[model samples]
Target: MGRVAGKVALVTGAGLGLGRASSLLLASEGARLVVSDIDEGLATHTAAEIVRGGGEALALRHDVSKPEDWSAAMAAIEQRFGRLDVLVNNAGIAIARNIEDTSLAEWRRTMAINLDGVFLGCQEGIKLMKKSGGGSIINLSSIDGVIGEADLAAYCASKGGVRTLTKAVAVHCAEQRYGIRCNSIHPGYIWTPQTENYLRDLGTLEQEKAKALSRHPIGFLGEPNDIAYMVLYLASDESKFVTGSEMVVDGGYLAV
Candidate 1:
């Protein structure tokens, strides 16, 4: 049997990048998924792809930053699946700006989507999971959250918030016996389409790729699968004893 057989998962930002990859991987491992994104078309496309691959999936246009949307999503899940087993808070944005240059609006927007969104997902997901025994909550953080970057101040702050928030949620769940486990996954420079766009905008993809690889001791940038592997481990029953931890999938970037 698959590792996550008979489980149900909700993946935010499932339209692309690591979220899309995680949604696909989880489904491949036999989990029915609720793939949600701000873009309805993309969410629908992702769900269709899973179903085409003979996996079960549902598409929802959900803005994770909104509490009402979270309620609606939980309601939909309850009506259809009856229980939620996993929640992947993978919706985030990176604003390229130094501390001095970062606007207040940009900072708030980053916090809203990156930090507030994850908070809402965890809060609502925990409530539903409590009803069904317990569940896993995975927050997608970044290496920027662990270390520092030149022009990603707001992004760093938002992700750092996620790191601590995961711990707090884990503690609360454990104390309350909510049966919910919370953890954060910090990824280094993964070559997703978003990063590709950044490289393309630099007008020197080869140079950017070389620079990114040079930072990693592994001599190569990570792929979406790297993060997905960790997500799978944390989402499965195999990680029953693991909670309130930060799993780094950085290809040794943080090691050096």
Candidate 2:
């Protein structure tokens, strides 16, 4: 049997990149998937892909920054699956800018999507998880969260917020005996659309890639599946004893 058999998992930003990879992996492991994205077409396509692969999935356009959107999403989950076993807060954006270059709007936008979204997810997740007798929450934080960077000021702040918020939520769930687990995943230099855009303007594609590759001692950039593998473990019963942890899957980027 699959590791997450019979579990119901909701993955935000499931339309693409790490989010899509995590959704696909979880569904393959037997979790009924709730594939959500801000883009309706993307979410629908992801859900269809899962079904074609012999997995059960539902598609919903969700904006994690909005509480109303979250409520509606929870309603859909309750109506379709009756319980929520896992929530992956994988929706986020990174603005490539220094403090001097960042505007108020950019900072607020970053916080809304990165920080506020996770806060809303945790709030709603805990409520539904309480009703379901427990669940797991995986927040997609970056290696930037643990370290400060001059260029990614807003991204850094927002991700750092997620790191702390995850811990606080984990502690609360444990104290309440809610049986829920909350944790953050810190990844470094994963090859995703966002990162592609981040490096595209810096220089030639090959030059930017070489610079990125040199950052990791592992000698290569990581694929989405690397992070997905970690998500699968955390989403499964194998991580029941794990909570309030910052699980790093950075390909040794932070080691040096």
lDDT tens digits, residues 85-119, model 1? 99999998887788999999999999999999999
Off by over 4 Å in 1: 200-203
Regions more than 4 Å wrong, model 2: none
Q: Which residue pairs show collisions in model 2?
A: none
lDDT tens per residue, model 2, 1-256: 4999999999999999999999999999999999999999999999999999999999999999999999999999999989999999999999888899999999999999999999999999888989999999999999999998777899999999999999999999999999999999999999999889888856587898898899899989999999999999999999999999999998898999
* Candidate 2 lDDT (Cα, 0 to 1): 0.94
Whole-model lDDT per candidate: 0.93, 0.94
Candidate with best TM-score: 2
- Measured with C-alpha atoms, the lDDT of residue 131 in candidate 2 is 95
Best candidate, lDDT-wise? 2
Q: Provide the clashing-pair count of each candidate structure.
A: 0, 0
**TM-scores for every predicted model:** 0.97, 0.98
Global lDDT of model 1: 0.93
